[model samples]
Every structure is written in structure tokens, then in C-alpha cells.
Target chain A: MLLRLSWLLALLLAALPARGAELRLLPPGLAYCDELAARFSRLPGARQDAARGLAAEGGRLCEAGHARAGVARLRRALRAAQGAPRLARSAHP
Target chain B: MPHTRRRQQHPGPLWRLLSSAGFRFALLFAVVFLAAGLAFAGVLWWGTAGTLERQTDSAIRADAMALAERGRDSGLAVLAEAVEERLALDAEGLSIYLLLDPSGRRLAGNLAALPPPRSGDSSWYRLNVEHEDTGPGEARLLVLDLPDGSKLAVGREVSEKGRLRALLTEGLAWAAGAALFFALLGAWLMRRALERRLTPAATTAALIAGGDLSQRVPLSLHDDEFDRLGASMNAMLDRIAHLMDGVRGVSDAIAHDLRTPIARARNGLEEALLSEADDPATLRGAIERGIADLDNVTRVFQAVLRIAEVEAGARRAAFAPLDLSLLLADAAELYGASAEARGQTLNTLWPESLPLVGDRDLLLQVVANLLDNAVKFTAPHGTIVLSAWREADWVVVRVADEGPGLSAQDRTRVGERFFRADSARTTPGSGLGLSLVRAVVQLHGGALWFEDAGGPPGQPGLAVLFRLPVAA
Candidate 1:
């Protein structure tokens, strides 16, 4: 019986993905995060840390299997990445 | 020619572009296009941004309701757990949540603190929550007062909407710039093409204005406006040249005709002064001859002025309807005695009452001139026929003379002022007789032409034919 229960558990685990093991199984949250990180890299060094932090959080949510929430987080990360350079330029100037 | 030479030193391309009409038109188009583009962009921004904002606000409200229901179903402990789960689920950090205790301490969610609650039932805030992580951004917050006096808040990031608006604005600006560049280029090309077509006419006009009367506008096979203008200008130039030649001829004839008479009078006076018989009859005879010579010169001048007045068209006011057949018969009758003395037979053909509108004196002079020329040029015993008849809308008059007819070349030039036929140069009288006749015919809106009156094969004499319009 214990062995049958362990097999059932294995089937359930297969049905519900553990996390970012299969990226295609999730939403486009991680892909969006990567795109935003690439854009932020072009900004000046003074504001790079804040942009990286936002992207890292978005990637974490995507890895944790919260796809819908992950997409929203990634969108926020992109906005932050886009806005950082302008804010840095203004603050420094 | 001098003007054309000056025009060849044209200004450079840049100067032409700045001064060209096409450039100004293109600039006007650019300004209008920019204004229209801005208006379109504004409408696009309003539509897209407004939709995005409304959607974002609704999502925020839904999130707030979900959390409030979660708290109502269980307690603050369960609500706080749900907030933690949501924060973990949201990898993008776009969702916001906060659970506050009765003393207002933030218990859960991504935000650092519970923002101060508002007085109204619902309100939106532009305040920044994750300032250290994502810089400043727009957020719509909804704070709900829990049954236990604690607070729950939810928000969604709205900075992406702003980014979209920025991208659209930048795109519109770039498009407007590209449109202006292309418009200016097209305008310059158009101006160049127009200038190429117009340059020839402008050059010809400049040359003509610079005292080159012989210059004429060039023509093309294409019957366009420019070609028509060239033809009209060429015709006008030809007329001016013809009139100039006429003036030159009249001046030469005046000098030649006056010199002989003046010289004869001077010689007679000198001879009388040198004579030893100082009698009054000899002096009176010399003075009388001089007076006659002066009178002849005076008559020539008077005839020239009369012809000029008729050609000026000022005698049209004196015109009235008169019977042309009667007028022809009267002229033939008046000259019949002279014709008989010269042993010439005068015949008349009349269509009873041929009517015309003209100056009576001028018409009489036309017939009289033709008759006088016939008498002067014809041999004795020649036949003269005077005829008047109506043909279509005109009254045709003919005074056919059996005289030595003129050549075709002489007939063409006979109506020019002071133009005398080569065969008749030795005859007495000024060469203005036929010219005055032509001027009178034209003033009456008629035509005067010469034809060979049919007679024997080799003796076809001149026919002076005139046609005048019958008045309504």
C-alpha cells in the first residue's frame, strides 16, 4: 500500500511541475525578466544595482511556479529597468 | 542680348532653393502636417493611456477585494498568510498588499509600509512604494477598513503605461521629421523642373526688353501655354518691326521729295536776284513760283497727317449709313468730263441701293484717289468701269482701269506708306495716294486689294477693289 501511495505521489508531482525545471511549462515571466535585464545593462553604472534587484525578484517568482504573478512582476521589472537610467541621469546632473 | 548674358550668371543652387516658390509651398505643407500629426498622436495617447489606466485600476480593486474576502473568511492571521503567498507568487513584483494592525504596523506584502489611508470611500495615489528597488513609479492603492479596525491595502504598478506613452511620442516625432525631409526634397525637385521650362521664355523677354527688337520667343511642337505665348509674342514683334520699317521709309521719302522742290525754288530766286532788269514782274514771278513750291510741300504734309488720323481709328464716330451705289455713280459722273477729255470711256455698274456704314468724305476720297490714279497712269482712249454690288454681308466696289498693271511683288507693297511702284516712279505726285486709300478702307472696317481686271491676255489692267460691311 505504501508503495502504491508513493507511485500516486510521483504521478501528482509529474502533473504539477516542481518549478522552473520546464520553462515552457510556465508563462513568459522569466523571458520578460531577461529582456528587461538586457535593457538595464545599457544604463550607467550608478543605477545598475536597483535595476538588477528588480529583475532578480521577477525571475524568482517565475522559478517558484507562480506564472500569472510572475508575468506581472516581470512587467514591473521592465518598467523599473526603463526608468532607472532617467532617474540616475537626473539625480547625478 | 545683354540681359540674356546677365541672366546666365545665375545664383547658386542653395540661393535658388531658399527663394523658390516650391520651397515655400513645401514648408507650408510640413507645418500643416506636423500640426495634424501632433493632434493624431495626442488622440492615440489619450485612447491607449486611458484604457491602460482603467484596466490597471480595476486589477488593483480586484486584488483588494480578494484580500478583504480572505480576511473576512478567516482572520488577520489567514489574510497575512495569503499576502505572503501572493508576494511569493508574484515574480514581477507588480502586485501590492499590506495588512495593518490596529496600531498601524505593516504585517505583510512587498511594500515596506502601510501608506496613510484616505478620507474618501475610494481614492488613487501616485505615491512610490518600492522606491529603493524600482525607483519612483505610479501605483493605485485601495485601503479597506477591516471589521476589527485593522487596514488592508492592494496596488498595481502603472509605470509601463507611461513607458508606452513615451515610445509613441518619440515615434511620432521621428515620423514627423522624416516627412518634412521628404517634402522639402520633393519641393526642390519640382522647382527645378518648373524653372527649366520657364527659363527660355524669361530669357527671350529679357532680351526683347533690352532693346533687341528682332528677338523672338522660341516655339515647341507641343501646343501648351508656353508655346501659345511664344507664338503671340513672335507675331507682336513682327508687327512692331513692320511699323518701324514703314517709319524709316516715310522719313527717307520726305527728304527726297522735298529736296527737289526746295532746290528749284532757291535756284529761281538766285537767278532773279542776279538779273539786271530789276522789274517787279520778274520779282513777282520768282516769288510766286517759290510760294507754289512751298504749297506743294504743305499739301504733302497735310496728306500724311490725314492718313495718320484715319489709321488712328478716331474717325469712327463720324460714320453713318449711306447709299454706296449712289456715291459710286456721283464719283464716276464728276470725273466723266475729264475721262472724255482724255478720250477714255467711263462705264458704270450699280446694284440699285447697296447700303454701307462709313465716313462719307473718306469714302468719296477713296473713289477719287482710284479715279485720279487711273487717269494719271492710263493711256488716252482707255476704258474705266466703276461698279458697286452687294455680296453676302458686304458691299463690294470696284474701279477697274485699263492702265499698265503692277507686278505681284509691287501689289503686295502698294499699301505701305510712301511705297511707289518702280514703273510709276517718274509719274508726277507723291507716292501716298494708295496708302491713304488703304487707311480709309481699314478705318471703315473694310479691306482694299488689287486685282487684274480681265481684258486682253497681255493687257490685264489694275482693279482697285474695296469691300465694306452693310450696316444692320
Candidate 2:
């Protein structure tokens, strides 16, 4: 009985590693999603409308338990909200 | 050895140049030029770089006002949108903009973050910014608080203006260097010209100091100031040389003329002393002859002293106004008896009044000397004419006789001290009479001349004429 108990403990340890690996593959947490939403809301100009639509879709996905997909959409929304004119653009032609 | 020592004592050319007036003037010129150039640079800086900076600040202020007005009339969101649009339109990326919410989070425009806030409602800030396109640079911004609790910042990068100012400063420095070089060159040239112009006079002075009295300063055809100075120096040197020659001539004449009378007087006395018989009559005669010879020598000395005194202007202080005609008449009357003794007719003619300023005794002596010469040289039964008159601004006196006139060469030399004419050599008088006459006339500012008396061909007599300036 003691031997069986040792085997069960090793199996449980293996299962915990698998779960941690799976969590690593998923998107970031709810805090990151909230930050991206704030950034998107602050964006200026007409290009922000498309980013607003993408953020709404990401919020719905997160509510439906597709956290990885929702996080991906939120990231795409933030990039779009940055708009056509960016700080990284060169001053000279 | 002295010449070598003098050469060694002279300074080098560089030292001379530094001490020269021309170099000093050049240094003054360079200093003035540098000051003027710096002043001009200051003005240019104000006109170009300073003006550009002011213009940039004005534009930034204008943009900030516009953004604030938009936020006031419409909303903070519209103001943010306007900032983004302006950043998109700026092709050179020189424009800078930042819109911040009340929480200090950047919402739009190119800037990543808002600058430090100040207490004022609106403020200007000069900040070092890391531009996304142009890297690090300076920016001038005007920050304004919007009505909706948002902030708008408008600015322009000023690195290009700084670069232009630096270029202008470098160019002005080069120009100043070139001007200094030219000023030094001009100073050296001016010193060379000054030394060249003065060399001739310096050399002549050196030669003269070494006992070469004939050396003179050379003149240039330019007839400039230096040439005029050289000419004046030459004239003074000539006058000095002439006076030296006159002194030598006077020495020779005194020795030659005085020796004869002294020797004769000595010989007569010696003969009397060496005689065989001790005779009183012979001794008295010899002694009397010796006295006469010594008296003649004394007379010559007295005449020389009188001439020297007159020439020295000693008699000028005793001058007073007197009628020259009256003086002449008195002299003629005194010498008339002498002319009568010689069987010569003495005739006098003069105006009633001939006023002039002179020494009366000296003028009388002048008339007496001419009349005596006339009486001595005139033939017996000849007419001796004495006349005086006023001619223009002068009192003229004339004495004419049927005597042998002087030759042309003797006329030029007549007034020289102890000079006697060949024709008058046998006469029993000193040759200082004409010289004394000349000295007295010159002292009184008068003129004297000898001319032909306009007599018969073989008897062209001498006429002594003189004129004194009329008294004012």
C-alpha cells in the first residue's frame, strides 16, 4: 500500500507539469487584456473605430472562455489603434 | 672701430618695425577691424538665428492656441484628433505634438510622454527630446491646459538653426584672420616707404657731421613734403659755407693790408736810430712820419670796428625821423671847401623836404665819404655835383664827379672789406670806405649803387647814388 501511494505521488507530479506547460502555451492574463483595452480607448483618429470593433470581439471571446484567442485579438486591436502615422516614421524621405 | 661699434648698437629691422609709428597705426587699425567684425557678427546673429528662433516659438504658440480652442469649442477628443492630423501632415517630422489626459497618459501625436508640468496656465519649455525620426535634438514648445482637463503641446525641433549659427560663426572667424594678415602686411610696407624717404637726409647729415660741408640732402621730382624739407636744409648749408669762406678772406685781407704800414713805420724808426749823426730835425721828421703811419693804421682799425658795429645792428636802436635832404645839404657844404681847394666846382641840387628814418650821424658820414671820394678822384676845374630828392617811397642822394669810373668786375667787388680798385691804388686812403657805406645803408634799410656820371667819352665819371626808405 505504501508503494502504491509513492507511484500515485509521482504520477500527480507529472500531471502538474503538463498543466503548467499548457498554461504557458495560452495567452496572457486578464490584467494584460485590461491594459490593452485602456490603450485602445485612448487612441485618436478614425482608425480607432476598427480597433474598437476588434476589442469588442476580444472581450466577448474572453467571456466565452477562449482566453488565448481573446488575447491575440486584443493585441491586434492595440497595433491597429496605433494608426497610420506612427512615432517610428522617419522625418526625412 | 667706432663705426663697427655704432653698427652694433643699431637695433634689428624687426625691432625697428615694432617701434615705428606705422606699425602702431596698423595695430590700432587691426583692433578696430576686429571690434567692427564682432559687432557685425552680433547683428547677423540677431537677424538670422535669433529671428528664426523667435519665428519657431511664434508658430508653436499659434499651434497650441489652435489646439486649445478646438478642445474648448468641441471636445478633448477632437483636439487629440487634430494633433494626430498635424503630425501626419508634417513631411519633415520637424513638428512635435503631445496630447495628454488629466491622468498624464499620452493619447495622441508623435511624443511618447508629456514633459514636466509648470504652475502657469500656459508656459514655454525648451526641452531635449528623443525624436523618433531625427534622434536627439532640442525642441521649443508651448504647453496649454484645455477646458476639458486635457493638455496640448506644440513644438518644433531647432537643431538645424543651431547648425546654421555655428557655420556663420566659423566663417566670421576666418574673415577676421584674413583681415589681420592684410593689416600686418600694410604696416610692413608703410615702414619700408618711410625709411626709404628719409635715407637721403640721414646720409647727408652723417656726412656733414664728419666734416664734409659740401654734402647736401638730395631732392625728388615729386616735390613732396620731404623734398621741401631737403631743399630748405640745402639752402641753409650753402649760406653757412659762404660765411665760412668770407671769414677766411677777411683774415687774409687783414694780414696783407696791415703788414705794409707796420713795416714802413718800423723801417723809418730803425733808419733814424742807426744813423751816424744824432740830428734832432731828422729824428723829428722820422718820428712824425712814424706817427702818421701809425695814425693811418689806427684809422683802418676804427673803420673796421665801425662797419662791424653797423652790420651788427648796434646803431639801429639810435634811429629817429629826420629829413635826409637837410643832412645831405649840410654834408655838401662841408665838403664844398675841399672841392674848391682842388679847383673843382661843387654844385648842389635837392628838394625842399625828403623825410626818412635813419641814424643822422651815420647818414652824414655816408654822404661825406662819397663827396670825399669825388673830390679826391675828380680832375681840377671839373664839376662835382651833389644832389638829393624824393622818389616815390625813397629819399635819393647822388654824388657825381669827372673821375675814373670803376670797371664792371670792380663794381661787383667794391663793397668787400679792404678791397681797393686798381685805379685807386695810388690814392692815400683805406679801401674800407665803400664797405662802410654799404654797412651803414644796409643797417638803415637803404640801397647803394655806383653808376657812370654820363660825362665825356674818356672822362666817364663815377656817380655814387643811395636811397633810404621814406618815414611813415
Candidate 3:
């Protein structure tokens, strides 16, 4: 009976993540947490704190089915994490 | 001769260089090159400075637009704080800024003073701007009035652009100077080379002009244009020398040949006068003999003059197309009686019409002289043949006689004035007959030559052949 109950718990764990709303936010076959973590890993050490905080908030929004706002926030996090250069070298004046 | 030679001086190197055609060409090229270079440099300067000025104006307008929008969104104080923040950046003095109140006093920013405002989308004005590390610097400025009665100024320092322009101007000046120097040097070198090529011809000309007829322009094996000209001039000089030799020969021959006849006539008269008896018949006979000798001498002079006139090409104006066959027939007829009296048969072989362009009277004389020579030389019962026919582009007339032909040595000298073959010295005629024939032949653009008519060795008959160009 204990083994059966353990198998049932395992099944439930796999089924729960697959059924979550954040699954749609990931690219096909990718896990939500993994995509967020990949972005998190590319952040420079000096900028990791801000990027991590933003990515965490974006991941939570994806889980709540706010995919549009989540994708926008994720892009901002990706930009900060990647340390992209400015679009233009604007004059200082 | 030595004194005369020493009088001519060598031309100086400077004079030769200056006089060379190549030097003139090079100088002209240099002037044109420099003028074009100056124009090109001016265009480059104008284009580069104009581009920089446009870029600065564009940047100022964009910055002002952005700042004006920010000022509209927030208050004057916030815009002032933004301007201060921009000036505070660690960017090295490439930037300028000025914020002024309605009273026109600087409230915030880096610029120390602004010029009067001008109207345009973006107008450039000169400004002095203060920097933390570099004290005050000159800048290009653009000013805009805000809705709150404040003025915002944006500018860029001109020192870097000015430094680049100064360097470019200096480079252009040096390039122009170097171009001129090389042009002059090239011109000088080219002139020297041209002078070297032409010097020999000039020297030869000077020598010839100084009365040395034997001097000729030297030639090399290169066969270039100058060499060809030298060769042609040498040929002309050779022809002139030959003519001079011929003139000298004629003069010497006249001095000796005329002296004999005059001396004979004088001696005859002296004998007639010295005879002791009063004899009118002897005196008359002597006078007649003297007159004959004088006539012979006069005939020689007349023949010489006629030959000279024919060779001068003056009779070419009287040339007309005539039938050579008819002329041949006329000559055979004219000399037939003389040939018959000598017991020689005169035969003529001519085409029905043998046309040629020549002076008719001269050509008739030519035929007459040839026939006469044949009639005079041939032995009794010998054959004299006169023939006329077209040979290729020429009208050929041949007079052959069964007489002693000229020896090879005699043939070479036969057509010269006063020259007679050893065999023909006993004949009663001046030696100028063949010479006159040759001159007439040459005047008609024809050739005259002799050949041996078939016979035994040392007894071949003389065949005189002459050819004239057929009339077109």
C-alpha cells in the first residue's frame, strides 16, 4: 500500500506541472522554471541581483496566466542580464 | 680653316634646356596640373567642413527636441536638473550646455556665454563654454526658447575639428608645392633628352651652311624618324654632289674641245694669209673651212643647251598624247634614203598605234637622232631595224643596227655629254647625240639603255632601247 501511494504521489507531481498555466509561457517542450533560470544564469555577477528579482516576478506572472506582461518583463530581464549596449551613443550634453 | 673652325661656339647647357620643346610641354603640363589640384583641394575642404557643420547642427537639434519635450513634461527646475546631470557625465569636453531664465542669466549647465538668438530649425552660433578640467573652450552652439520663457543651449567644442582641418590644409599646401617641384625637374630632364636627340642634325646643318658641302647628318642603325630624315638628307646631298661633278666635267671638256676647233680655223686662216701669191679662190676656201669649224663648235653649244632645257622639265607643259608608232614610221622614212644611199636596209616593225604621253617635237627628235646614229654607223648593206610596241606599262621603241656595239666600259660613259665610243670617233657628228636622247627620255619619265643584238663575239650589233609611260 505504501509503494502504491508513493507511485501515485510521483504521478501527481509530473501531472501538476504539465497542467499549470505557465506551461504556455515556455517555448514548446521547455519547462517554465528552466527558461527563467537560463536567463538568470547569463546575468553578469554585478547585475544578477536586479535581473534575478525581475525574472522571479515575471515567472510568477506567467504562472498566473498573465503571459503578455510576463513576456515583456522577461525581455527586460534578458536585456539587463545580457548587458546589451545602448541603442545609440548619445552625446553627453 | 682652323681660325674659321674656332669661331663657332658651343651652346650653353642652360640655353639648350630652356630652348627644348619638351621643356615647354612639361611646364605647360605642370601649370595645368597645379590648377586642377588647387580646384580639387578647394572642393575637398568645402565638402569636409560643410559635412561636419551639418552633423553638428543635426545633433544639436535632436538634443534640443528631446530636452524641450522633457521640459514640457516636468517643470523648469526638473529640466535644469536634467541639464546638470548631462553636463556632470565623465565625457571629456565634447559636449556643451546652457540653461537660462527669462532674464538671460545662466541658471544651470556648462556654457559660460551664449550669442544672440537666430531663427531657423537649427542655427549655429559661437559660444564659450566652461569645463571642469579644461577651463573655458570655444564651441558651436544652437539655442531654443522654451514654453516657460527659458532658453536651452546645446553645443560641441570646435578645437578637434579645427585641428583636423588645419592639418588637412597644411597637407594640401605641401602636396601642391611638391607637384610644382617635380614638374620643373621633369621639364628640365625632358628638355635635355630632346636636345640630345636633335643636336647632331643641328650641327650638321650648321656645317653645311658654313660651306662644307661634304658634311652630312650622321646616321645610326636605329632607323628611327630622325635617322630616316638624316638618310634622306644624305641622299639629297649625294645627288647634288654628283650634279656638281657633272658640271665640272662639262666645263673642262668645253675648255679643251672648243679650243681645238678654234685653233684649227685660226691656223687655216693664217696659212691662207701667208701664201705669197694673190689667190682669191684659196682665200675663199679657207674662209669657208673656218666657217664650217665654227659651225661645228656652235652645234656643240646648241646641243648642250637643248639637253639642259629638256632635263630641266620645262617641256612637260607641252606634253600631249601622241602615237609613237607614227613617229617611228616617220623616222624610218626620213632616214630610209640615207640608209639606202649607204647600201643599208632600214626596216621598221611597229604596232598599228603605240600611244605615249610626251612632247611630240622632242620625241620626233629622239627618233630622228637614233635613226641618224644607226644610218651613220652601220656598214654598207647592214640591217637597221626600228621597232615600237607596248611592253607592260611602257611604250618601247628600239633601234637596232648591225654595227659595232658599245663595249661595257663605253656603254657606261655613252650617254654623257661630249662622250664618244672609240669605234665611232671617225664618224662626222658631235658626241652629244646620245646625251640629248637620254635627256629627252628622262624628261618623258622614260629609261634608255643599250643591249647587244645577236651576232658573233666582239661583233654584236648595237640595240638602243627606250621606254616611255603609256598614256592612260
Candidate 4:
């Protein structure tokens, strides 16, 4: 029965829909960027520079008018920051 | 919740649209291609409108700043002429603009007047600016009092936003078309996949309906859901074939097995009927003969039922490991004595410790049946040999006799229930021996076959082979 269930899961996976690969980063403004960064304070402090680099990349992308790439990169940066130690300090503050 | 339930009861339009093959294929094709087209239109609109708006806003601001740097009255005159040129009534097309003072008077612009702001109006509005000269509606750009006190307005004959919106609407219509196209393509693929699956099923059903009981549906790669369906149908047909053959053969078997003793009983009864004295010994003989015939009939029915039960495999629970060598020895010894009395020599070759998994009674019966068949088939002065040994995975037993070997065609039908070889039609035994042998062998998950036991066929006979699985 467990084997049967696995087979069914495989078939279900085969039937899944394809989706566009896209990302959205620091909206059009700095305020939007800061608000998003605060939300993404989960990244480790050690990784914060990496996150910043990614955001810079996203900014570069947005400048190039590739908003999808920009958003994706920014989202990745925010996700990385979600684990930041500084977020714990600010949670109560 | 009720609405949800109702919705479930009544499938959505999208599902209905998806369910139809034509619609689904068209939809899939349309989704891919039309999405491409729609995405193209959207990007076109965004790029054109955004660039135009940015340029216009910058141009207007620069013009206003330049004018405000001059004296206010002179600037107003210059602005009027500039505004007139910049905001010339959009080719008499309503793509126009207006600059209004804080009091709602047009400071210097081509627009006739400013309509009161719609309720809860925001920073900017894309309004359908109308015109008496042009047709129904025209789009306009309106700017209010500037911080510098020089109201600025500039318009272009090209209505980018309006055109973009029109383009988007067109794109959506195109998207819907693309959706239909994609749906059709998907449905065509689905049908082929369905056909690949459905074809074997339809063929199998046709095969069955056409009376080919032995025919089977071939399994495909993956053994998918369709294969499951095929397997299920195959099982059903298997049962049907068994029953149809079983009923005809069973009835015939009952008759053949019963008739020998029945004829004996009739002969005895007729003698008693014709006798002058109703003698006690004569009556006893008649009654005994009748009883014997009835008993034989009962035995035949019991054998049939036992074979049926074994084939059903439900009695595998009663299965146990048994000594196969001992069973063969016993059959050979018993038959050895019987054959000796019948003027035939019995030979034996029993090996040690053939650890086999089988029902003791069934294994014993299999050995007994083989020995009995060899003894019955061979003539007087013939030698019957019974032997056993382990080979590969099976404990095989052989019972060969000095008798006439069955032809190839006859050998094939040897295990069929109630099938007696034409030469054996005059034999006094029921044809159920080898049939029962087959049933027992199958119950043990083994096989029975014939082999040329490499002896003189005249006095040392046809060989019968039985193989059973040896316990690991």
C-alpha cells in the first residue's frame, strides 16, 4: 500500500502545472525597500553582506528594466535576512 | 459552506470548459501562445506609456520652470502661445490638456474648461476627454496650480495610456483566443494518451467476446492505471473460462467415473431378477454391487470437489512441510507389492531428505496417482520404476513403466480432466488420475510433465515426471 501511495504521488507530480520564474525586490522607493528589509530580518548577521550584495544586484536588474529578475533577487535577499540575529533584538523594541 | 457544496455539485464553467477535449486543447495552445502574445502586448503598453509619460512630465516641468523664470505677465503671454502650440487640439482629436488656476479658471490652455473633480478624485485621472469636432471621446491630460504659480500643461496627439489600455483589451481578447487554441492541442494529446490506454482494453474485450478463452491482453510498460484495468479484466475472464470448461468436463467426468461400477451393478441385478429362487446370496450380491457403484459415484464427486478446493488456493493455510522421500517410498512399496501380484516387477530408487513444502496427503496422492498410472498402463511382465531426487529448486519424482508411450498430441491433453487416450478407452480406471496430479502439483506451486526416461518403451514404458518445490 505504501508503494502504491508513492506511485500515485509520482503521477500527481507529473500532472503539476508549469509556472513562470519571477521575483520582485525593493519596489520603486527606498521606503518600500526598508520596509521589505525589516520584514526579511531573519537572515544571519554574517550573511547580511551577501544579502546586501543580492539586493544591489536586484537594483541593477531593476535599473535594467528586468523587474522580474530584480524582484526575484530581492526576495532571495529578504528571505536570507529573515534569520538575522538583529531581528530578535528589534522584535520587542 | 452551502454555496461551496452547491458549487461542488454544479461543476464550474472552467471545469466544463476544461473537460471538453476541443475546448481543453484549444485552451492549452491558447494559454502558451496567447500568453506570449498577451505578455508582448502588456510589455508594449507598459514600455510605450511609461516612456511617453516620463518624457511629457519632464518636458512640461522644464517649460513651466523656464516660463516662471521670466516676468509673470510676459511669461503668461509666452505661455499662451507656447501652450497653444504644444496643446493644439490634438488633430481635432480630443487628446488635449488644460492648466487651471486655484479658482478653477483656465490660466493658459486650449481646453474649454475644467469639469468639477469626480467624487473622491485622486492625484491624476485618465479621463475620456470628449470633443464636438471629433467622434465620441478623446483622452486628455489635466494639471492643476503649480507651486511656482505658473500652471503648466502639455499634451500629445498620441494617447499612449488610452492606446495602451486599448491594446490590453485587445490582448485579453487575443489571450482568450490563445487559451482556446492551447486547449485544443492539449485535448488532442489527451485523446492519443487515452487511445494508447483504451486500445488494449478494447482489443482485450473483443478477444474475449470472440471466444478466445486462452487469449490474454498484453501488458504495457509502466503497468499504469490502464494496466491495472487490463489485469482486472483478465482475472474476470480467467474465472469465466474456468467455469465454462469446468462445468462441461465435470458433468462428463461424473458420468464416466460412475458408469463402470454402474454396469457391474446392472449385470448383478439382472442375474438376480432372472433367477428362479430369490436366494439370499444372490440378493446380497445385487445389493452390494449397487452399493459399490453408488460409492464410486460419491468418490468421483469428492475428488472433483477436492480438486476445486485446491485450485481455489484457500487451503494453502492447511499446507505444511512433509517428507517427500518417505511418501514416494511408500507409494512404490505399495505398488511394488500390487504389481508383483499382477506379474510385473517394481523398481525403486528413493533418495534421502528431500525437504519439500506440501500437503502430506496431496503429496502422497500425487505419488500414488503416478505409480498407479504407470502400473495400469504397462502390460504383464513389464517393470515399473519409481524414483525421486532433488534437482535445482525442485524435488522431482519419476514413475516410468514398460508400456505404450502416448503420442505427442495425446501427452498434451494427458492432464485434462476426463480426457482418456483413445487406446485407453477400454481401460477400467477413471481418467481423473493425471488430472488430480496436475491439481496437486499446481497447489504445491510446481509442474508435471513427461520425459523419455531412456528405457525400452515396450517393457519399461513411458515416463511420468512430477516436480515440487523443496523448502530452503
lDDT (10s digit) by residue, model 1, range B297-377: 998999999999999998989999899877887898888888999999889998888878889889999998899888777
- Model 1 C-alpha lDDT versus the unseen true structure: 0.73
Interface RMSD of 3: 25.2
TM-score, per-candidate, Cα-based: 0.62, 0.63, 0.66, 0.57
Name the best candidate (by lDDT).
2
Candidate 4 accuracy as TM-score: 0.57
Model 1 TM-score, all chains together: 0.62
Q: What TM-score quantifies how close candidate 2 is to the native fold? A: 0.63
Q: What alpha-carbon RMSD in Å does predicted model 3 have with respect to the real structure?
A: 20.6
Which parts of model 4 are misplaced by more than 4 Å?
A1-93, B1-122, B132-137, B140-246, B270-274, B343-346, B379-382, B457-460
After the best TM-score superposition of candidate 2, give how far the Cα of residue A74 lies from its true spot, in angstroms.
28
Q: Which runs of model 1 end up more than 4 angstroms from their true locations? A: A1-93, B1-168, B205-212, B219-224
Quote the lDDT for A28 in model 1.
Answer: 40
Specify the poorest-scoring 10-residue window by lDDT in model 1 chain B.
Answer: B126-135
Candidate 3's C-alpha runs over 4 A off are A1-93, B1-178, B273-278
lDDT score at residue B368, model 2, on the 0-100 scale: 94
lDDT of 3 by residue, B1-472 (tens): 4565554454898776556587777667666666667567668866886567667777777877888899889977888876754543312436667889888877776555566544766455655444433345456777788887888887777657666766886887798788778867776676666677678888988998899999999987789988988888899989999999999989988887899999999999899889875788889999999999999899889999999999898788999888888887777888999999999999888889888788989999998999999888888999999988888999888999888888989989989988888898798777889999999999888899999977577769899999998862
